[model samples]
Target: MKRITVSLLLFLFLVTCSQSDIRHNQDLEDTTYSIVEDKNESVIRLSSLTTFDWEKAFLFSPYSPQEMIEEQLDVDFKDPSDLDMRDDIYLLVFLNKGKVVQYAEIERQDADFSIEGNLTPSNDGINIERY
Candidate 1:
């Protein structure tokens, strides 16, 4: 019985851990896939602008951004239950209105995606002050 219990626990641990690796090809994910906006418009898509595959490399690292989600805050933090635990966070870096800014790797299908994640000159980035 003890062996069975230990085996079950170990299996559960491994199962929980493996999900972090799924869909986590960080090179392909991090490498920028340029989306041309137009000439003189000077807009670019930041969805795939990372050169580092922080997701896979940092999945188990203590410094991972997902660590930021587990803590409680006065401000609204996206419920991880609502988000794909497998979803990796990336920086959406681009230039807009002559200022460079970084956005959270947000997908339209993400439950966490909302008007709040949007970066705008008017926001002055006060919204993203937290981790």
Candidate 2:
């Protein structure tokens, strides 16, 4: 009887741990945003910034000849989606509840660049979609 009880408790503990891990992964997925490329244009897309407590959004282009940085974008996504991606490469950063959640690296090629996917920012970076 003692061995059976111990085994049952162990199984419950394992199940609890696994459930917690699953929840954590789901949370990450929920917070992800995406950027996509369509013929001659790149669109910044997200589910809903306010849903994740997103506080800030910004875009910076390091390769541009002139300093171009867009700050304090609409958290509710009222801002324009077609950003002026004049440089070959760019970085899009998003703050979720005062923490950096995105480091999306975007690249544009002539007019042929194609992009699509979940643009959610993570430590590994947000996925950029090209079309």
Which tens-of-lDDT digit does each residue in 15-114 have in candidate 1? Answer: 6554333333334323322222122222222233443322111111112353353331222223333333445343332233332222234331211211
Q: lDDT of candidate 1?
A: 0.31
What is candidate 2's lDDT per residue for 48-67, written digit by digit as tens? 33244344445444443222
The alpha-carbon root-mean-square deviation between model 2 and the true structure, to one decimal in Å, is: 14.6
Maximum-TM-score candidate: 2
| Best by the lDDT measure | 2
Each candidate's TM vs. the true structure?
0.25, 0.33
Report model 1's TM-score to 2 decimal places.
0.25
